[model samples]
Structures are given as C-alpha cells and as structure tokens.
Target: MRSAAADRGAVHRPPCRADAGPDDLETDVEEIQNSVYWHDTEPVEVGEPLDGDASCDICIVGGGYTGLWAAHFLAEAEPSARIRVLESHTVGSGASTANGGFVGLTAGKVLRRLLWYYGREKAAGVYRTGARSIIDIGRFCRRYDIDADFAMNGMLQVVTDRKQLARLELQVKRSERTGLRGSFKLMGRDEAQERIGSPQVLGALRTTGALVNPHRLVQGLARVVRGQGVDIHEHTPAVDVRRVGNGYRVSTPTGTVTANEVVLATNAWQHSFGQTHTKVMPVWNYLMVTEPLTDAQLDRVNWPGREGVSNSLSFAHAARLTSDNRVVWSGGRWYYFDGRDTGRGHIRNAAAFRDLRESFARFFPAWDDVRFSHAFGGPIGWSRTFIPQFGRLADGVVYGHGYTGNGLAPSHTGGKILRDLVLRRETEYTELAFVTVNQPTFAKGAIGDTGAHLFVWRQETGDRLPLMLPHQAALAPRAFFAGRAARKARAADTGR
Candidate 1:
C-alpha cells in the first residue's frame, strides 16, 4: 500500500523565516501552562472505575470516541443488547480530548493511493464515504443536542513555497479526475490570505470539514450512552482477555467480565495485544493554545470564515480559532519512543512545545504579543501503511485503529463498520475498501526503530525538496543543518 509517487517527493520552495526579536520569539508570559484547553471550559463528570467481576452481552475495552460511537450505534440497533465500556482513564482523556479537533477527511494521498490500487470508481466510493462521515457527525451532534461547539467552517491546506504548489496541483488533479471536482479547489496567494490573514501562506486548497470541541463531543456521547443504559467504567483497564467455553473473559485488577462479544477499541494502547505490536506505532504530538483574544486584536486577521488552517508540509503545522477566540496551534514536531511505549511521561515534551511556539510565531507574526494559556498533547496510533486498520481478529475480537493522526471523522465511520460486523450483517460500510484491505506491519526491535526514524526523515526531506533542481542545489547547505537539528531532537527524546 506504499505510494511510490508520494515517496518520490514533491518539490516545494523553502519556507521563509520570519524576522523577529529574541523576546518576540520567546515570550516572557509566565502563565504558559500545561493542560487540555478544550476540557478547561467544558468539564465532564468522570465515571467510577471498574468494580469487581461483571458480565454483559458485549464488552468494549476503550471508552474513547471509537468505543462510545460503537456503543451508541449498537445500542440504537439492538436495544436489549447489554454493552459495557472499560477505560483505563476517563472517557475523553486520550486523543479524544487532546487532539486539534479537525473533523476532516483522511484523504491525505489516500485517494491517489486507492486510485492506483483499486482504480477510480472504488477510490471515489471510499473517498465519498470518508467525506460523508464528516457531515453525519454534525447531524448527530445537532439531533442529540450535544453542544460540542461543532462548526462546518471547512479547512485550508496552505503552501508557503512555490515547490509546494506543485504538490497541491497534483492533489487537485487527482481529486478532479476522481469525480471530487468542487470538493477541492486550489486558491492562489491573494485568495488564501482572504480566508486567513497570514504572511507565510502563499497558496491554499479549500475543502469541506468541521471544527469541534473534541472533549465536549466525547463527553456528550458518553452521557448519551449512559442514559441509554450502557454501563461505562473508568480506570478499569483490561489486564487480559481470553476465550472462555463459549464467550470471552476480560480480566481487570478489580474483577472480571465475561461477554459473548468483545471489542478492542484501544488505539495507541493496542500494544496490550501481541497481534497489534507491529500493526500500529504510538507517536506523541504536542498542541498549544493562546489566551482569549481581545476584539481589537481579532479584527486584525481577516478570518471571518474561521476555517481550520494547516500547511501542506508533512507533519504540517495547524491552527484553528476556538469559540472564545483563542488560537489552537499544533504540529511541527512529533516523537516515537523506543519499543512503541505509550504512557503519561510521553505527554510532556518541552522541546516539542518550544518548537511549536516558534512555528506559531512564524505563521502569525501579528500574534507574537499574545501569550499561550495551555500546552498539552498525547499519542496517536500510526500504522505502517499510514492508513487506519479495521477488521475482526480471532475469537470474535473486533477492532478499529491505526488512524495515524486523522481519526475524528473516520472514527464515526469506523463505528458503523464495527456495528455491522457485530451484527454479522453485510452492509455498505462493511464492504468499504478500508475493511477489506491487507495492511502490512513494521519489523521488530532495532530494525523497526530505524525504519520509523527513516520514515520521519523522508517526510521531512521530501517536504523540503524544491521542485527545481537549481533551488535544491542552493538549499543543500540548509538541508544539512536541518538534518542535524532533527538528529539532536530525536536524541533528546528519552521518553522519560
């Protein structure tokens, strides 16, 4: 499922560095803190941890969006089915609450790859399904009165260099050739700045998507599930899961649960299962939020449409305006611990946040004076093929994960797929390409670590390669310096 075209690299111009004083780049705002900003305004009541032994018709291992959505749809379809969700932490404590909250398509070269693999029609069908998921999520929020601060403001994939324009053009042509004409439109410098006033943005591709308060969305789903008689237990990690005489037994520290069916919705933590070790790798990403902007300050930018903006580079920088007018900025630096470890210690990377803060300054020079109110992050599941994995495992153990960094909308679609699988029904969702694909896994031990490192290096290098060889020749020295910085950053990531 690897993309030779994508691997060959896209030519993009080198990004221009913004001129700023040392003070401007590194603010004296002592209030810079660490917390999930989305949860600060919307606090959710945490459910009690799993108690002593229990049994149900179905037991879900994770209480995040994937599990909650599965519970929601399955409960709606089968009212009498007993469902229980077990969480190691709170419902929204994982990537559900900590992500950038962009409910966009997972068509990051997916359409192109699918076209090469399955041709235009099947690729179009899968791409359309992914797009529909975003719209359906908005409808779900409205019908249930779940105020997740969801806004259908679309998204912008902007490019700062001329080399990057070629990449955007390729994407646009692929979209048009695959019957997604109006869905993706290329915007020049002037048109892009009109949507978001940023000096670094030279061009952009506009696409439909929604921004959400991920914390509120997940909490609202949990409440709805609980109201529908679904038992959800927090702090109840599944220590072991094995097949019983006719069903499965899930053992926890406090007790055990026996169920006719089991679901492993744990994303990054799927390492608990030996089968998922190479199927997914947990990568840490950081995010930061600025204090609320004054009305006068907000007037400086012409982002009245409030579109979620991200650069076209790999491991791109992303930004969106919150309900309170604060800026949620993320990306630029990502970390992968040895042996694919995932825990609380991996959440705080001061160097990563520092790099993000500097990027924020470069993107929005006018906001240099604004101080960040919160900075926090968590791990996301990354598969070798860069596509999410969804299918049934042995012993009636169903699962959906490996969303890489894009899971918000896809999780909803995944819920539908899991529901069909649970009922043993052959529906449209169950027939999608994502459900029937054979995804490869990474190697074990040092080879695996080196492979992951090389992947990151390729993405960074491919992103920096200028389309014209002359430009690449001119920036050869700069590339050497960039490589050194990347090595130093990786060495500093002790995952302590």
Candidate 2:
C-alpha cells in the first residue's frame, strides 16, 4: 500500500502555494456562500476518517454528490460491501458547496455540436437523457425527502440582441427535432420582458429548468447517505491512491483503507494529482446576492414567478428570486484564472456587483436600489472539452469532474451513473452518452490555456454580440474551426 506521506509527496509539494486565494475559494463562510434559497437549512457536522488499516468493497475519494451517490448505491448493490467515503474536507466543501445553485439539464459544446454534425437520433438520445435527468433528480429528492428548495419553475434562455435570435431559433429547431419532452418557445423582447421582467431581452427560450438550494442539497445527500449506513469521514484527505492487488489502497493523513473500487470526485482539486490537473484547468467565476427585495417591489415588476433565467452570452447571466425576497444574479469570470479570487467586492468595477443589478432593472424596473446584501465569489472547475467527465482508472478506481460550472441536477445524475459504472450494474439510463473514460491528461501548456481561454472568451464575447449586432448571427462551428487549428498547433508545440 502507498504510504500517506509518499502519496502527498507524489502530488502536491508544499508550501502548497501560499497563492491559493479566495478567488479560488470563496471567502467568509459567514457571508452568503450559497443563495438565500438554502438560508434556512442547518449545516452538516464534520466527521473523522478511519484511523487504522480498513477494508471496504468500495471507497470514494470525494464526499460531494458523486461520492455520496456512490455510497448510496453501494449500500443497495452490495449490502455487505464495506463502503467508506474519505473527504479532503467537510462533505460538499468543493464545487458541490461552491456552485451558484443553478441546476438544469443543459448540455454544452460537444452535445450541441453533435446535434449539428451527427443529426437527430444520436443527439436526441443525449437530449432525452438530460430531460430525464431532471426527473431523476426530482425523484431522488422526493424519495429521500431532501429539502434543498428543489423547485421546478423552469429556466429561461433569454437573449439580449436580435442577431442572436437566429442562433436561438436554430436551437429551438434542434429541440423540436430531438422530440425532447418539455415546453419551449421563442419570446420576443416585449413578450420576454413580460415574463422575465427585463426589457433588455431581445428574445428568450423558456423551458422547464430549475432553481435550487445547492448547499442544502449537498448537506441533505450527505445526511441521507450516512443514514443509509454508509461510513463517511470528513477532513480526511486521500493522500495517495495506487493499485493494490485486485483493488486499491487509499492512504489518508491518519490511516488507510483498502477497497475493491475507488471513486474520485474532487473536481479541479484533482489537478493537484499528477494526471487530472493539466486536463482540467481551473477557472474562476463570481456571484452576488441582493438583500430581499420587498413583495411590493416584486409585484410592481410582475416577477413573482418562481422561474430562473440565463442569457445566451458566452459567460452566462442567471437570475432567480429567493423566498426571502432577494434576487441572486451572476455573470463574468476572473481576469487571470490561476484559480484566484482577485475580483471580489471591488464595487468600483461594478461588473461583478452591478451588472446583475442593471440586468434586474432592465428586466424588471421595479427592483431599483434594492442593495446587495452579500457577495461571494469562488473558482469553478472545467475540463478542456467543456463537458463533464466520468471514467475509471487503474482497474477498480473511478472518478468524475469537469461540470463546466453547471453541476446541479447533473451531480445527482452523475452520481447515479458513476455508482452503476463502479458496480457494473444494469441501469436504464446507462444507454445515455456518458462522458468518455479517457484517463487524466493535460492539454499542451500555455497553448492549452491560450486555446481554451480564446474559445471560452470568443464564445463569451460572441454570445453578447447578438445583443449588439442585430443583423449577424453568432456561429459556434466557425469558432470551433478557429480554435481547432490553434489548439492543435499549440498542442504539438508544447508536446501535449
């Protein structure tokens, strides 16, 4: 078995970068870490990891949704399986706790392109799974009686410019062809304003997405998983993982656990480990919440609806109201995403704190001067492909990461699928286009970062172009072509 000390040396060599900043991790847990939707829930208490050599049929390296779900499933799959979870920190401390509490079945770049390049049947399967994922999540929450403010008022893919209208229309057409089960519509600026309470909208595609209490969900899952008799340990970092005999041995600071199967759900932190760090470049994002606006304020704008809205910009803008009368809206990323929170509470920039306020007024003029109660910012993890990943490594070891900043419902879905993959169980959802199990690998150097940043930046910028350029539609395939050449040449240059 790999010793804990040896594993630590293999991965992160301290001082572990004193530069690890709050931009990478949000600051002050006293502030609003998650939105007001989860304001009422209690926090989960910390637990200890195994202190002696132990054995389990399955051992999960993360305590987030993925690990919790794995434990939940293992209890059923092999009731006798000695299942244990070793978290680097408290359960849900990673992206599971840090995510902006937005959960929908929206798939990203590859999925969208697959529809355009591969046609409907394949794409339909992907879309159908996404639609069903929403149902699956709801079922889990209901079955477990998880109170994460799991609301299904739906999501609005709103647009702010006429040029983007064509792109949105194309997506609408693709949605129709896929025969995905959900109601979707094209709302013009005026119609959208009526529903969104934002006049800045030029168009919108409103569908059944959801607004959630992310931390609450995380805590709830952790609770129920423990209740199911899963052995969970917090503040227990998996210092090393190596194949041992037919299974794996996970070494922590205080002890070790040998298991038949191991799962890693550490997200961007996985990069600290030799392989995943380079493949999954860490990115940062910022979010702000307003003090509860009065019911009188909400009624004037006609935005009392429980729905949530996201714009078509490259960097998305999402807004939803809290039961407490606050509206949490967000947009933009950090300038240098070395996983730092360089831009927090610099109210002077206004981009982070004020942009959403502007959006609220443009969409719903009734919410003026409703001051921001709090602002919290943190790093969000993404993979090179911009698709969330799921796979096994070194025989019985498996892990999932790269939610690309969208990890609400997907977390639940990923956990269920991941557990099934670990146990080799037959699940009806297994037929979905799950993320490929390519082992942890990195893109070539600054070339990789440059290419990634460019595409992300380009998409981020172009998404807003439709708002500014009324006559020309934004194109993704063209962006792909441009990025493909640069990425390949750069990859070769760096030997990636």
- Model 1: per-residue lDDT, tens digit, 239-341? 8988899899999988999999898888888877765667777888999877678888788888979999998777888999988787899987568888877
Error of 1 at 109 (Å): 2.4
What does the lDDT come to for candidate 2?
Answer: 0.63
Best by TM-score: 1
Error of 2 at 209 (Å): 1.7
lDDT tens string, model 2, 1-496? 2212234453412111112233522222223223322333354567876787888888888888767876887687767777899888788766676555777766434556656655667566655666676777777789989877777788888776555555575576567667752456555556667787676776667786777777777788788888877889888888888888887888888889998888887776776565455656666665666555665666766454667878765577778875555677666644334332223232223344444444545555555545554455555667655556776654556777777778776666677778778877667445444553233455655766676577667766766552443323344433432443465478568985
Query: What TM-score, computed on C-alpha atoms, does each candidate reach?
Result: 0.88, 0.79
lDDT of 2 at 104: 75
Q: What's the C-alpha lDDT at position 444 in model 2?
A: 54
The local distance difference test score of each candidate is 0.79, 0.63
